[model samples]
Target: MLARSLEARGAEDRTDCVSFPRIELRLGKQRYWPQVLTCKLFRWPDLRHLSQLKRLCICGRCGRSPADSITVCCDPYHFSRLCEPETPPPPYSRLSPSNHWKTIDEPTEHDTARQLRRNEPSNSQNQDWPDSSALPSVTRDEHWCSVAYWEYRTRVGRLYTVCEPSVSIFCDLPRGTGFCLAHLHADGRHEMVRRTRGKIGGGILLSKEGDGVWAYNRSEHPVFASSPTLVRGHARGLTVHKVLPGYSLKVFDYQRAQALQRAMGPELPDGPFDPHSVRISFAKGWGPSYSRQFITSCPCWLEILLNNC
Candidate 1:
């Protein structure tokens, strides 16, 4: 039966439609279709039945259901298994911030004193740091309900505000998408974002659904995301997630951020820390799992600064 099926053109021959005879074989208490059994015997040894696979007509033309004169093709090459890519595990185990801090080697007292002394400025040296009081205050525009804004860092930095509920960012879109950045000037540092012209299919789509923000990956290459709300319960170390093409992930949760803010209290840390900010890299990932330690090391990336979250 296997030899005859192999020799038979099946659907490969464009002129005529060849159909394999329906045969059922029983082994112990199990019954199997001849076509499915043949497929498992030669091509996919692990494939169970037609339910786990999709059949494609090799002749390049066939409808979902054939007419009375047309026959179904049973060629093993015409079938493909349906499956999704597995997500990689986080870099660190379930260790809280305090516990994770304890794992690191503490600095020596002398080293700490030396570092403090090095940071301290001398009276004779003129301070290069800009005075906070001298800078003008920025106020938000009341015209639109701004949820978030993207900060792009290329040869020169540019900011694009998101006033609408949903927005699409792309390099080159023929239809003139939500926020087209193709005409924007860039240098060698922004080459990765510029390469999405004709090579990659589409760009990312961000939508404000309910209290959370969702990011849909429509591009050919995967997008990497790192958000405070997404890594709430995890360790202090950065956690970067790889979002595959045609997949959507909830990048930010407003309720979770509020709860986290309440737990943290009014006292803020001396170091720069923004609980509502999110970072996404295009076509590249950075974190403990990857060679790049920080998102700044990525070629093309977006910094999403959220408001009133």
Candidate 2:
């Protein structure tokens, strides 16, 4: 069975489509289709029918070419299941107030009271400047207003404050950056560097924009990210999003965080959950889809702890 599976996979890799010998699969009295069985075995185990999956254009046998007689491809990787669409919030009302008119000679008591208050010194105007003691003293790091910081497995780095709009996090780039993980002497830094020496070309760029933090994947490999903002709708499981090279994604959304904060509860997944922190793994993805289950298990992963988020 293993040999046949391997042969089928090899043939599929070489060509656009490859067929396997038909085998009858049954549970009790009910029989399952070959396509459904293949999808369940390879793609999504919870997948029940072939209708749940959509074939990719790369699959030559799957309705792309008019000349081709084959309509379906049993290749599980060539098909992807549809995801539930997110519903947007309702629109606000635009109803205006009723208009009123009055004669120039008819001055009401309300108008006289308003003019009296307007001429009088207001409470705020009376206090021209606040007392020096009332104001909070600025610390050395106050200039940088650090919203977040990065961390390895156990070793934590300095607070990632940004005087500028954005900052670049790299491994061994010559240019200056806000934070350089390559200089840090973490436990698995050497191993991660060794594994992704040449592949870690141009690390990711993090920018603090309006109401959100964006992560641009400048590296060659994909970057996996998981945060409260990212997994706001998914209450049952943690959702890890993969950002391909050159692609950018909002890792942290303040507006979404505020909305989820009130509804969020203590019930979480098996691993440790830091509601204010975001975990990003470089080159490797660690989640339900990948071999590594958590970000800690990843060779090179970063934990971004947000402040006043």
Candidate 3:
């Protein structure tokens, strides 16, 4: 209501402004979408003092922005100008009543089923997978069980959910190679020796020439045992899963592992050893069992691995 607003501002001398109450429109008991267009006048010749008046309102149909509209009255002719474009409803679909007026009859259930069948797969056998029991069990002495088992934290595979049902597991060897369970166990000891700089908490080194020892206070063994899931194989290649409670574990493809080794090159020892066979070991359970094992042992092993790498 520009007129009312002007009057309220003591500027009745300007042009007229009025808005009627909201009007509702319905079509066949259903309300159709509406679009509103409003215009505003920034200043009027006679209402120069009330130029600062700012009143913005929307229309019943579409909520158009007429906030900065300005109305102008030049002599006998009146003109209204709005800056924003008026958005209208999208065009009707080509299959509307106008195009298919006689097709309102519902299709029979048989007809619908026929159409669905026509587009369905020809054989159910094409989509069915062999049962898990039929699938080969992951070998216990697989090489991937070594490093891949430790890196299982970052493996790519289906996330298990009780509410949802699915089946997925990996059992193939990695591209280059993977460490076996025995190798992983033996290497874990090497990791401990390298990490503690030949002084694993209780001061024991694997070798006089080697840095630290894995059997420092008997804490590292449990840690290594807890991370024995690498024995599980993937149909494709090795896949690791992060099961540690607090620590975020990740599995790595060969490329990622190499990249990580390169990134850590600065910290690596000058040995000819490659980190490819070394995998991370995580403790089991949320209690002190997993934490104490990993915390005490991993650093020792990590230090060992770093030195050998």
Query: Which portions of model 1 show Cα errors greater than 4 Å?
Result: 1-157, 188-201, 232-234, 267-270
Candidate 3 achieves a global lDDT of 0.21
Q: In order, what lDDT does every prediction score?
A: 0.47, 0.48, 0.21
Please give the TM-score that candidate 3 achieves against the real structure.
0.17
Predicted candidate 2 versus true structure: per-residue lDDT over 58-170, tens digit per residue = 34553333234333346654444432122111111111232111101111121221222233110000001111111123344444234222232343455456554456677
Ranking by TM-score: 1, 2, 3
lDDT of 3 by residue, 46-146 (tens): 22211212121111111223332332212111111111111111221123443321111111222121222243111000001111111122233331211
Q: Judged by TM-score, which candidate is best?
A: 1
Count backbone overlaps in model 3.
40
Q: Provide the global lDDT of candidate 2 against the true structure.
A: 0.48
Q: Please give the distance, in angstroms, between residue 130's alpha carbon in candidate 3 and its true position after superposition.
A: 24
